[model samples]
Target: MQKDLIKELCLTQDLIDIAGTGTASQSSTSKWSKENDAQRAVSGKEFKDFAFHTDMETNPWWQVEFEMPVAVEYIIINNRKRSPFDERASELSIVAYDNEDNEKLLHSGTMYFGSEDRGCPLIIPLKGNVSLKKLRITLLKEDYLHLSNISFLISDPLRSFGDKPVFIANRGDGLGERLRALLNSMVLAKEFDGHFIFSWPLSFSKSEFHAIDNPENVFGRDFIDSYLVTRDVLNRCEIKDLRNTMDFISCDNDDYKKIGINLDQNSLKNQIKDKNLQPKNLISEYKLAFEKINFNEGVTEAINLAKSVQLKDKVLGIHLRTGDIVYSDYRYMDRYYNKVVPFYTVESLITRYLEMGYDIVLFSLDSSACRYFKDKYGVVISNDLIPEEYDDIQRAFFDIVLMSRCTEIVGGLSGFAILSSWIGGSKISTYKKILSEEEIKSSFTHSLSENGVLSSGFISPLLKSFSIAHYLQSFKDFSSIIERIELLKKCIEIDNGNNYYRLLLALDYYKEKNFSAADGILLEAVNSTDKSNIKWLAKTKFPKITILSIYTLELEKYASQGSIVAAYVAFLSRYYYDEIDMNIAFYKDFIQKQHNNKNSIDTEFLKEIQEKVNLKAENL
Candidate 1:
């Protein structure tokens, strides 16, 4: 008696045969044609009733196509329990093909056919959740292929993920350290397939900690609530259990073993000194999810300060980092950098920027450093001009905001320096060796050239204005949306066809639930052939089917043209029409472009991404 082989699993659960026409390397002369009928093997009935048989060959292969890309957890293969052919499925390889024609080797080597004495259903669990359009099984060393049944357990997103989520209890760390922790957690959440509770409380007292501003004080309360899932929310009845029961994890402990391919030994030593300071292993797919940190009142005030100070558009920003840093962390700095570079004094950096034709230089330093620069260069730091009660935390936030507005930034080795330069959106220059006038001259000579100049004023205004609009959209406050819309409209009137402004206007409409108005603007922005707009478009969830279809069509058109942003958008599209191939294409194109440009640091970053995707840099 052939006992019921399939047990434990809900054989009658929401089962569907999504397999399309199947093809094989070679067809069998038997009636079980290697065509669409191969899907019949998926039928949960007795294995003897149906099987996908193929003719004898060196390496025979059989493939099943799914109607759409489905998130698969595991696949169960039923082998014939009969005599000789029982072990036919022993050495086989399974490959999954996404819609973009990218192939992933899901399973290989020996089969999971439970032992000879007491065989169970051959279940092959996927390592991670993946979306696939087709699956192929090939005989590696075997001469024949016989597949009884191939069934997959599609993923249910609503179901809790098996592994517990992580949360961190951040101590009184510097703002940069805190931010790095947040960034690290984002990486963990993506890799581990779990949520993260941002547990850093806004209000805490630490005499040792120089800066400790509530997140709401820097980024608006409304903005933080919308984008970031706060720790306060985690304490709620519905979520508290999940937080308490789930594992408590911290990114500080993550060794970042995967981040060594791109950096040299010296650079690696500096980065790894503090785990929190390690350069983020950025995953493009997770970019939208990491958009939690945005601008707030602090940022707004920074912009107003920039304007009020009348710091010329082409100002240079310098973080000499010689205030509390020189005395408190001198040993720490010496360890990483090998020696003290004396040329990074306040007067020297200010003079350097001035020599490069910068009208002013924004200084994010202690008042002592500020006074030193003023005494020598007769230049008052921007912070000195702004009248306010400035605590260390508040001052640090102000400095960060101000630095982010700079056209170009040069700094010493510090995580805060790195953050300011990055958020400022410019080519960052750092000094590792002894900073001589010659070295400074060699670096700034290009800046002194016209080609090195960036539109100093535009980045800040664009980012700040968009931040406000994004905040309003997140809250879905109709009245605020109206005000935002008016502001964006005014910007558009001044600078027509600015995609960022247009996207903000569109989002304002989307927040107001005016899909029609939003669609009109989105359609215009999408048609412009600018890839930047695609990220914004991807963030939006259209309420109307017609608008969604239109947007998808426009996105496809751009994606086909090899726009990485469009391809990314298609990958993130809510309609689930995108495949892994789009991501592959986007990365290939992006790597090729970045590789051509000889920016060593940026190229290293690209190489890190290449390593993440298992793609060899030389191959491209």
Candidate 2:
């Protein structure tokens, strides 16, 4: 009944690749060569190894008859060519047949492949209960059909849960912290009969603020097979770089409070429903997941260290972490903000537990905090628990084991503390700092301007530029329209090549009715708008938007690719000239259609623009 007891490996979920055993065939009347045979599709080799290719013929199709009927939830397809998007594969049709030849249309839709989906699975979820004996996929056009690989994820026990996929997306976080996401996902996978994928941080030493390695190196196989990286027995991230941009439903690692200007709050709410997902059953899940891993010499040594500590049954755990030093520059403070709960704040928990007579274990990254805890109540120091040299991962796992053994824990607002409590079956109280709306706006690591809008590490540089432009537009408290125009000019000065910022400046100028000023920037925005950047940069095709009545022909060509903000602004400009008018029904229909294509910045912009548009339309 001990919460922290290390038990044997528990295999709750089993994921296997059954595509290789199946028989594959293409159209018999086809004049394609033998080298481009259909068997290659079911070869089950890593992506880019080989593919089943077909000539540019009408309605090219490939079929595979499974060795046996199996219950499947997702079918992952990989295109031979990632970049320049295999447009032939864009509009695809899939059909499946049971043993009785009863057909079920598995999937029929258009899929967008961005740069993130490169060398990764284009996951397609099946609708309902599907037991397939044979499957066929068609290009649905007169185009060359080249497929690198096909995979089916079948879990009979977890059939009812369907396609609720989970992804362990830990970027630059520590082992113990990432494990919290991994373990929670494993628990959820079993609880809901689901499957999960992960991208492990490189085993290389952690750099100050930068990632340990570039994305290319970190996602490489060397890091995946590294001794330090924990591997899933059933489903490790074999198809690495698990980017969920294209995926509609998935759980990625994200701190709820850390969300910024461009994040989708509604989508985040759906992903992390904290009420149902607390680690009440984590201790058992941890024991089962790592039970098989104990045989590793390093793991055994860590376990022995945990046993050697031999702390009293009623042991108290105190977890603390210092993400960044309070440096003079304060650039690194964002990582630490809201994570640390002051010692004085949790002093009551420590004192109350001490009166109840429990042993104490202080596990911390902050040496000074450890000293304080040890000095105050004479707690067991896990930092000094390791006798001599320690592997970075082993040392962290040692901390994990020790913390899990505690009867209760007083810790900060981090996954490390929350997950440790789950593992030890210990009562944990996390002291989180509360921030006002204004404080939250300026909290993260950012370069704040005189107008007080912040831009920094919270968003990718590409998106940060877009989000900053959006914040500048929505800064209600500070700047006048003329003042806002000056800020956009300065922003454009700093990032001269940004078409997004240029287009935003045009929007502002138009609003001021400065047609000449708007027209000047409109020329710059048009000339700078590069479809190549859209096609190749992120392969996102996310068009830069503008509301100028004299919008360029090139801009009109890709206007559909722009966010709803573009649609509204353009429509309003037309409406002002009596060129077009919209009702509530038309506006709602537009939102419904353009909702999925929107990026985070679009979400933020849409919220502000939507409110203004809705209020104005109420009068109409």
Name the best candidate (by lDDT): 2
How many clashing pairs per prediction, in order?
0, 1
The residue-level lDDT of candidate 2 at 169 comes to 33
Residue-level lDDT tens digits of model 1 in 43-113: 44445533667667767777766433555656777665665676777888888888678999878898646
Q: Write the residue-wise lDDT of candidate 2 on 32-125 in tens digits.
A: 4456378877665544423667767787888988643556656767766555645567777889998678898877888754211354446666
Error of 2 at 78 (Å): 20
Inter-residue clash pairs, candidate 2: 10-288
TM-score of 1: 0.33
RMSD of each: 22.9, 18.3
Best by TM-score: 2
Off by over 4 Å in 2: 1-172, 188-197, 208-283, 292-295, 323-335, 344-349, 432-620
Give Cα distance to truth, residue 126, candidate 1, Å: 38
What overall lDDT goes with each candidate model?
0.48, 0.51
